[model samples]
Target: MPIVNVQMYSGKNQREKDILAVAIIEDVSKILSVSEEEVMILFTEAPHGK
Candidate 1:
């Protein structure tokens, strides 16, 4: 299993997040030789400039 932790400022909307998550999942799974189900993406959002 591969876990990707993304920490970024909190300003993006749901559509952006969804698109990013899907892209990340696809690339990570392909590069890591893991199934999409085994690839995990965790986002930790914070206030801008925080």
Candidate 2:
């Protein structure tokens, strides 16, 4: 199983997050020769103070 963790400023909407997750999973799956279901993606959203 491949685990992916992505952290960034909290700004994207649900659709964007879904798209990002799918893209990441696909890339990881292809690279690791594993199924998409075997990949785990974790997103950590954080606030950015200006």
Question: Number of the top candidate by lDDT?
Answer: 2
For the record, the alpha-carbon RMSD of candidate 1 to the native fold, in angstroms, is 1.3
How close to the true structure is residue 36 of candidate 2, measured as C-alpha lDDT? 95
User: lDDT score of model 2?
Assistant: 0.94
- The C-alpha RMSD in Å for every predicted model, in order, reads 1.3, 0.6
lDDT score, candidate 1: 0.92
Q: Where is model 2 more than 4 Å wrong at Cα?
A: none
- Residue 19, candidate 1: C-alpha displacement in angstroms: 0.4
Q: TM-score of each candidate?
A: 0.90, 0.93
Per-residue C-alpha lDDT of model 1 across residues 1-50, encoded as one tens digit per residue: 89999998999998999899999999999898889999888999999872
lDDT of 2 at 14: 89
Number of the top TM-score candidate:
2
**Model 1 error, position 28 (Å):** 0.7
Provide the lowest-lDDT 10-residue window in model 2. Answer: 40-49
